[model samples]
Target chain A: MATILVHVMPKPEILDPQGKAVGAALPRLGFDGISQVRQGKRFELTVDGEVTDEVLANVRKAAETLLSNPVIEDVVQVKVVREGGCGCGGHGHGAGKAEKDLLA
Target chain B: MATILVHVMPKPEILDPQGKAVGAALPRLGFDGISQVRQGKRFELTVDGEVTDEVLANVRKAAETLLSNPVIEDVVQVKVVREGGCGCGGHGHGAGKAEKDLLA
Candidate 1:
């Protein structure tokens, strides 16, 4: 199993009214020190089996075709933070049951 | 300077059409192994000065009030990845120029 983290942000050229609004409000709310408050989203995904290059490529395509607009969004960076191990210093398929149901 | 990372997702009770759509498309796209493909966003903010506990709390409140919907979203985790240093083992006021302009 692998855990992937992804971030999506608007293209730099695009006007981020949400970000701008937050920027304007931060100071008024007593956060005078806060500025340039651009906001985005984060996802933590637990995928069954190894998240290899091919698997991640398909995931990126899915993100592009459905999750975000290619014209307005920049990159869909995918990073594998942890790899599956039984804690015995070896591959663990035994506990994949929980993840299987999630993926199923 | 400090870099804060935030992740936002639909409350588990809410319907995630984007996540569902991507989940359905994954298998057909030949990524048969992929399942439970939920999508969210990530942000990396470079803030000038120290992001103390009070500063971080203010940031979280701002995020709750403007960036995210408290009713529909949960958690505004702000992690300070890096602290100000001249990289010379001391507080760096000299090079905060870039971040200051951004936060300004």
Candidate 2:
């Protein structure tokens, strides 16, 4: 199975109170250096088959349409993680570049 | 300035109602191929200086202590994005490996 990760972040112009609250709490809790924090949603979707381009397109559509509110958020990322690979490890550079192009 | 991306996901044993609702709605909305779905939080932290090892270490601590609930969530990723790089584009290889080692 291929796992797809979709990230939905608040638009730059939108206010992110949850993120602001965390940013405020961090300083109070002694975590320093961080000047800003934006909290966003991440979705991991386990697909039954290979993550073909069509599948990716569909996932992107779902990310934009169902996973995030276009009015206030942007689907910042949609990438596939290889099976058995740690979610953070398999960025799939080729896929990533292609997806970015598609987004552009 | 540097950006750190932290991903926190629900533990496998935990019940994620939000994810389940999205999963159930996908098929109804004509999006197919996804077998399972899990929702998580992604934090984009903008730091005022270079993301040194000390900064990463502190961020990891913050991620575990304040960004996520240890009982139900896992800080699956803590990686730095380069300044001027799109958040999705700067998963530094050496940094990623080091962070994974630190987590291990």
Top-lDDT candidate index: 2
Task: Give the TM-score (0 to 1) of chain B in model 2.
Answer: 0.82
- Candidate 2 lDDT over B5-71, as tens digits, reads 8888888789999999999999999999988889999898888877778888889999999999999
DockQ of candidate 1? 0.26
Off by over 4 Å in 2: A84-86, A89-104, B84-86, B89-104
**What's model 1's lDDT at B21?**
73
Q: What is model 2's interface RMSD?
A: 4.5
Clashing pairs in 1: A41-B41, A41-B42, A42-B41, A42-B42
lDDT of 2: 0.77
Q: What is residue B73's positional error in candidate 1, in angstroms?
A: 1.7
lDDT (10s digit) by residue, model 1, range B21-85: 77777677676566565555444455688777777766666555655676876442444455532
TM-score of each: 0.64, 0.85
Report the CA-based lDDT of candidate 1 relative to the real structure.
0.52
**Candidate 1: misplaced stretches above 4 Å?**
A81-104, B28-31, B44-46, B83-104
